[model samples]
Target: MRQKATSLFAVLLLLAAGVAPVGAVVGTGVEASAVQSNCSFPVTATDATGTEVTVEQKPENVVTLGPSEAQTMWEIGGKSQVVGLTKYASYLDGSDSRTNVSGAGRSYVNVEKVVAEDPGIVLAANIVSNETVQKLRDAGLTVYKFEKAKSLEDIYAKTTLVGELTGNCEGASETLSWMKDRISTVRSAVEGSDAPRVFVSQGAGWTAGENTFINRMVELAGGNNVAVEANVSGYGKISEEVIVAQNPEWIVQLGAFGAYPKTDAYNGTDAVKNGRVMTVSNQNVSQPAPRVVYAIVKMAEAFHPDAFAAANATTTASETTTTQPTESTTESAPETTTEGAMEGDSTETTTDAEDSTGGTPGFGVPVALAALAGAAMLARRR
Candidate 1:
């Protein structure tokens, strides 16, 4: 079908958008520590390129080759040290002040611009090509290329490595602590709840599959990814026939442009029939940064609202008893409610809840009916 062809094209673009060159050196046998140790200057570590990278001292200025790298710097309180970044990172606060090292497109990097910044260190995302990195090195720059983040654990490791490289050890530790606590809270909230069949639509019928961060988020949020069930690997398109057969209870779209295709297969699904479709910010879900917890929490709250609300109440009560109450101590839990199910009406019951860091909440849907629908589908399939 024309829609299927478009979906395939979208996925191919996503793969190529990373800009990873053919025959790039892939990190082999790379392992990240569960807990970060002490922070010391002149630290030595092997990067994703299997090259020994040493930071002789704390970097005074750094350059980021990708938006995710820039976002990580902002999260760890090292934004001040970033003197340059790609234009894609413009969404970050005060990013306009940083030098733009972007080339003609989102995936291209301007080596001349990066060299012009004269940064003390350069942090490269996995998407950066080996030739680009080698060119920068030949120009007499110290560049550390990170491996692709496959899981939350991998993200944690990258955070640690970034902090160690930039000498922002304290900030990294604090960030990690916050991330772990939030994840633990979410996991506890959905501990015994039924997991609905969730289909993640990245627009144009593109779906996230196994070994991808989006898939991990769905699992963490207590939903089974339908793309994984269909045996779609990495970023790929799921056939319309397969979507109708699986009959997902919830459909989560990434980014503002994400939408369910207008077709019988999508229209007939329970997600469309029951108003269980929701959209979340692509920045929070797509980027491998600390903010990813926002996507996970949003999904969990939608997938299991009652359980999430109960857990939040207990957490608030516990915090109140342990510490003196302050004006900022109040937790804002987003109310979840069902609306009239309408086809293509994804924002009907969306709500926003501010996170602990005062970050704006992403879109969410309160989907209490998912459990019932999921159970019925399972019974029929059996």
Candidate 2:
């Protein structure tokens, strides 16, 4: 239960700026301070909405209202403290013990069940309305609402905030360090490599555009996002004609299912004829948590196999040959920047909103990443 408020700012600042492994050091000033402040109570923290919340004691029972928050809590070593979560919490392998207590989409919250749990702290995202937050506050409950994170910096800030609240600032620092290292690793691997024109599909015609984590992920992995190139911002749908017009070299579908059923739709495109279409797990890509690193690496390998040849290369020449790039190497694709998208003005059409309560059953991650994801699913069953 160590909560060092002193090093909190410094650690968070490093993470928000993005991780560079060149001269990074962990657990010196900030981490040591966190370790020294174990079990500290009456701590004050500010939420993403500029609200200051003071916790008189360590929260033994916690409730997370969103998948991203739940995943963040687990990363900061507070998973065992979570007592309740939404039905979508099932995405994490060991979430069976946590009961589903969310509303239908992202608006309503089951206030009755939330109060019954007697949680010391209740976590929520921006999608949760102000009225609902007031209801919980009126009941004398502690609630912290996180604004919708549009960038990696926002995610790091939110993660650090949770660490401060849960008295796991040390864990938070460690997790952020891990994330920075992973991101740095991927970036270095793909440096100076060609950025292939890639279409990121989340099934049902929805795709991630600017102001979204997925968009940033593509840029970090050295893949040109065709949706962003088409001026599509935020999660929106583009017509089939637009897809044909763009003619992406690679199609990286985010969910369990592919947006395009057969190659007929992409008959002449590079993704179909060249077999460069890939399916990634929704849980890894959708949740803005530590698992995002997995998504970055997955897309990097797909977009630039040659960039990762050294690490992926095996002693056997035959297996090495298999890892070679099959698709045409994109030489001069557009370089992506972290441009924020307009909120609520997106024209993209999505089958379902994946705010906090949505779930795609058939989505699956690679076996290696899946094992790491499961191990991160720390639980504290009431």
Candidate 3:
């Protein structure tokens, strides 16, 4: 099972590579008929397991097991097609009305409930047990799975894949272009600023390191990840000694504002003494999707106040003094569970990151929505 899961992950990596060979959506024998070559039929995509999955028809009813998948589907104009979603996916705007197939607490799917939905397509994440995916396939359901994206590039790839599956490739392309533009704006805003040494505290002990999108976002926001600099990779605990030795200038917490209040470990740190510790919404700062740019902007504002201040002042002045009008437009979790052993006999478990390799799936639409809300709050403050 583990080996099969690994193969699935490799295929997702290939999908994240942005392109793959096309194949026909085969008749898996549950209830699906043979696919015919048409606009919707004969759609082919590779799953995380390296199996080529072809949809005989464009899915009229879709079930998304990951919040990120739901959000991406919505962003790509496929919301009307979503008929089912995971319980946690309720965080999305329209998901509350969708049928909740997976149960609460655990990240595993309820195979019986899923089959009852009789969905044309089931979108899932790597955190879903391979057994569950196999069972769905056995039942003649088309299941499309993806591993959590680890970077902006991965997010684009995933978005593109969703677009292709939903027959919304144009929407996906436009979304990708919008994300790039937003990122470029942020980069230009923070250009030439000295990058701050930063620590991303997901919880009391968990911190983001290399090979994770959080680390990438921090860099894009003009800050250096202290955890990555410590040679830590993925999600891991950072020792107090390391924290003390490398006193970060900024601390970005995943939870509420008071989550990481002043403590012995932070007493002398620049972030603590200067009161620079910021609590970004976990949904936005954590999720790896288009809305991630909002978090990046928030981070940039926090990390280099001077840059934003200058930019804001310039904008304000230009708006107030010049006779110019501008047009503006705006738009737009997880598939896996992981069980980890904590300190005691009782096992501590975490879902995959919005895409979780550690505590919970950190990437999804709710995270993005929360990030957008955070951006709004920051905007109001300005």
Q: lDDT tens string, model 2, 222-289?
A: 99998898898755666677778889899886443324534455667788889998866544554555
Model 1 steric clash pairs: none
Error of 1 at 379 (Å): 45
Give the top-scoring candidate (TM-score). Answer: 1
Off by over 4 Å in 3: 1-41, 104-107, 256-258, 308-382
Off by over 4 Å in 2: 1-39, 104-107, 261-263, 309-382
Q: Which sections of candidate 1 miss by over 4 Å? A: 1-15, 18-38, 105-107, 316-382
TM-score of 1: 0.74
Best by the lDDT measure: 1
Q: In lDDT terms, how accurate is model 1?
A: 0.64
- lDDT, candidate 3, residue 323? 18
Across residues 103-212, which tens digit of lDDT does each residue of candidate 1 receive?
64223478999999998889976656666778899999999876655567766666767888888876777677667666777898889888999999765576777866
TM-score of each: 0.74, 0.69, 0.69
Q: List model 3 lDDT by residue over 289-343, tens digit each.
A: 4555667778888888888766655544323221111211111112221110000
- lDDT of every predicted structure (CA atoms): 0.64, 0.56, 0.58
